[model samples]
Target: MTTTQLAPISARAQFRPGLTPAGLVTVLLGAALPIIDFFIVNVALPTINADLHASTATLELVVAAYGIAYAVLLVVGGRLGDSFGRRRLFLTGLWLFTLTSLACGLAPTATTLVIARAAQGAASALLLPQVLSIIQATTSGEERSRALGLFGATGGLSTVVGQLAGGALVAADLFGTGWRPIFLVNVPIGLVVLVLARRLPESRAHNPLGVDRLGTVLLAVTLISLLLPLMEGRALGWPAWTIALLVVSPFAAAAFVHVERRMERQGGTPLLPPSVMRLPSVRSGLMVAVPFFAAFGSFMFVYAMTLQEGLHFGPLGAGGALTPMAVAYFTVSMLSSRLVARYGPKVVPVGGAIVVVGMVALLCTTLAAWPQVTILDLAPSMVAIGVGNGLAMTTLFRIVLSHVPTDLAGVGSGVMTTNQQTSLALGVAVLGSLYAGFSESLGTRDAFALVIGVVAVLAAIVTVTARRLPDPRV
Candidate 1:
């Protein structure tokens, strides 16, 4: 594929030699770190609880804090990137994320670790939005498509690696670091990223508007209202406050929309521009993205629990079991751009079909094998899910950003990432809860089957939504 150099947006547009190989790898590494950290904590949580004497509630907070802060701040992070500069925000975010990670590793108490994780999540929000925005600002055409595909691949691989690596790291107990290596490992990688980020060409929105303080507050509150309750409610036994927050969430969301609309009418810059949503690509692509990621997020959560708890596998064994699927995912994701080129929007629906078939096959295999099922027995199902996920993720990412204007790249990316992150968290809350609830009554294997079945249904919805997407060439 040919590189598309950054087009001049104004007389002062920075000279960018498109995305250099080094520059692309640098930003993609930056993108992968936050995602890896998100799931890496799963295997380490037991060790953390034992080491820090953390209560169950505090342990849950350790995970939820990062996710809540990350989701709530993402849109604002995007706007900041647009208003200031993508490279500037990205570098700043990376630095903060590195430091916060260090704090997490060194914290002596659960509270301190929870606080540090929240800060790390905020830093991640800042770091992640700039990745796609930079790509959106710097490249176009086939170059843009390929970069997005790689971004999707990096995202997919990082989650799996986080699980496997987390287990391995904890087991190795490097330098007697115990669970600390997972966070500490980011220190060296972040420093390398810091050096490489200097080579990234800086870009910002032309005629960038002032930050929308009111809109930012409303949006953050709205997301927090919805996400906080969902993520923590089940763990906390559905407190009355959780119910209240859930009730208020819709109103908060409505208020956010009203505020943004008013800001747009007053000729102010909204966090998400009104016109951007008018693009058929944005609306339809997000419709599919939400369910696709929701299924994926919950599947990972539920599958990990099943492997460790129900199947009587240790952390290392559980993580290793997923390696085959990860391999399949990475391999297929590498080739997704070619598939998209051949099939256009049809690629998404085709991917959905594959995922359905995979889930059904896995369901059958799990039922037949039951207590004796091994990694090799589930290999075909894992490979099937990976291939389908690979195709859907890469192609859909390209479709969502394909039609966004360069000036709106930051906000557009923020919206897409926010949709994805929220759905992922929601998947854990809603679908994970369902699995937990079912496991109490039906036992582990049956509950897992039920969750997989639910995910397949969600994938079917993605197929239907994919039909509404505009042709990529449009």
Candidate 2:
């Protein structure tokens, strides 16, 4: 069904009547910070380890803590926003995020940094979902599409920029702060965004739903079981508990789903209302998101390794190599709204085709130029993928929320973002593992080619699935 045809929710009546350009910009900035933070530490890990004298496990925690907290609490955060006020949660989370970032910057010990990172992640969970919910509630039609497009572009650019910016900040060590600058950099940005956020119109669900305490607990357990093992299994040598948790994760997820379904039957709010899953756009769009983001994560991980270990590029050099992709992605993303408006849902499949072509080109280049490939040699393939990424990502964001009820905007966004984040973590775990295994047996060039081939196949599958999405213009 088209979004316009969906039954109206009581909550939409309470939606603030106006959203200024400045207000939209403020929330968009809020959206960018959490995503950027997710990737910013990748290039700074080694420096953090050296500076803090952290053990390997603690170093891993520095990253894992943030990801786990962010992923686990996302849906709950959405629910909170729905129950409370989006603007209130946005400002509160932003403030907490800023404080935690400062704590991270000034942390003197590895333990302290890990603690601060975890808090930073918790704050992010509270902040990120509201961005999408606010836009979904406050904007419609072409304006909605444009705002969502900018959000997608912000996300893509943040991922690329996080790496590059992190490297640059660490290298510059402005005022002799060293890797501390990476975390500290967010302070001024956050302060500026906070001031701007005052302009945002407050919005909340009309008949506020009470917290789903039991369902929330079950979900936390489910996500932790699944993500913890995947994230830590490789590093911890695939421990028995990790395997056990992985095996139990599906059952835990099933239980959570069962509970949510039961809650719906009894006329209560569940953490993730199963009714939402019945929506074709939400289902198909999320299915497409999994593989798309999985490939994204794997590519970033493998590419970084290939650049640093295989090609011997330093952090700055490796991060810089992705500039072409970053530029292409930002450019296409800015124009994607027009593409979607003109062509509708067909943009996804077309973009997916472009991505496949780009992947093929990248794999071919690596095979042909093994041991001699440079950033310049890879620029064409990177640009192609970037263009594809921009189109697909922007279109997918709009398509997923195409028909969500206004009341459920926060939860819907939470569910979508959670799936994306989980897929990303899986990408690193699964594809990264595959690359590691293949490199040991088949060599780095062949391994990279094989991963690219696998990602290409996945991208092709996403294209096929995209064919099922209803045209947004309809």
Candidate 3:
């Protein structure tokens, strides 16, 4: 290693590397929190229902409200981070999220808790995008890729950890808090993170600009129209209002795009820059990412339901069944930077197939072990899915950002995250709706397998999509 020679150092030059261990931990923690929350509640739903008297619709609402709102506001959040300071916004978001989590824990009624969860999700949107932007602006080359690999690991591991941790929390019922402990746990950790955030260096990638007030309103409306109904509709018995809103979703979505395009033409600040489409890597990566994420997203809910509803495992057992997956995901994801360096963009397509086969194999084992399964019995299948998913998910991330310019890193990241969030909602709606509709007739486990098989086909499509990604735009 070589060091730059300095004749004399100013007092301010002490500890000049901004991407210190503490800062990296801060960013990784921020990125992990929101993703973990998305899955953590799944295993605890039964406990929550018994304790809070929440109906199935309400439980689904609790999850959907957070996810939809986060998906909707994410790009705007990134844009705000760009205009304001990333550090300032990240700290404020962490504080808001911490407070909202406390509110979630304390709410006496299901309605209040759902509202609090939604607010927490919105806060998460504000906090998450800024983490990556800070790292991108703060590092280069090997350092950048390593940070990104850790980010991707956080994304996958969060899902596994959320389920496992939420289960343990509910099972432990620390100080007899029961289901409420899940939300309450975030409060203290969040406070500590926020305090540490104050000393973090402030960074911004763009000149300050007015918030795109109209675009924000339009985008929120579009997402609500599309997302709210799908999640709530089935439980509500597919009301006409749900259908009406869904039918109008395309137009609402169209209006948002039209408005954004007009703003770009007038040289106004758009929430998501239209120019990102000109970059082949960005566009193609999103194409593969959508279906791949759609599949990945549903598996958590589908498999949890399979274990609990189909096989009648308790919360600890249902959530614990995924422990092998978490271990497999972390172990294999650690290898991704090395794998990508060896194989280039080819890693994503190859890994996608491995993941599909692993899913199919897991489903087969699940079917074989029905009605008399233990977590240990599921270990072999779990290991397969875990290793395969670690490979695909970590590699998919590399494929998505393969050519992003450093300056546009935040928006590029926001776009990739938007695709992830949207596809997740889409998977739950479509695959979840399918499972709901068919499970009664086919039985829970069989119906889950059928729906997940359809999801697997979508993953295969993503593999094909990955093949087209290296083509540059004309």
Among all candidates shown, the one with the greatest TM-score: 3
Q: Report the C-alpha displacement of residue 369, candidate 2, in angstroms.
A: 2.7
Q: What is candidate 3's lDDT per residue for 81-121, written digit by digit as tens?
A: 76677788889889888898899889899899889988998
Q: Give the lowest summed-lDDT range of ten residues in model 2.
A: 1-10
* lDDT top scorer: 1
Model 1, span 1-474: residue lDDT tens:
001112124334435557788899999999899988988887676678678987434555676678767766777776678678889999999999999999999998998998999999899878887887788778778888889778877877886788789889887888888889989999999999999999898888776557777766776677667766765677679899989988988898888888888888888867666677778899889889989988887787777667766776666777777767777777887887788787888988888888988889888998999888898888898889888888888788779888988756555666676677677767777777777678888999999999999999999999888888877866
Q: Which structure is stronger by lDDT: 1 or 2? A: 1
Residue-by-residue lDDT tens digits, candidate 2, 286-393: 989889888877776677667666776666777777777878887888788899999999999988889999999999888888888888889999999889888888
Q: Give me the displacement of residue 279 in model 1, in angstroms.
A: 3.0
Look at candidate 3 and give me any clashing residue pairs.
none
Clashes of each: 0, 1, 0
Candidate 3 deviant stretches above 4 angstroms: 1-20, 55-57, 136-160, 471-474
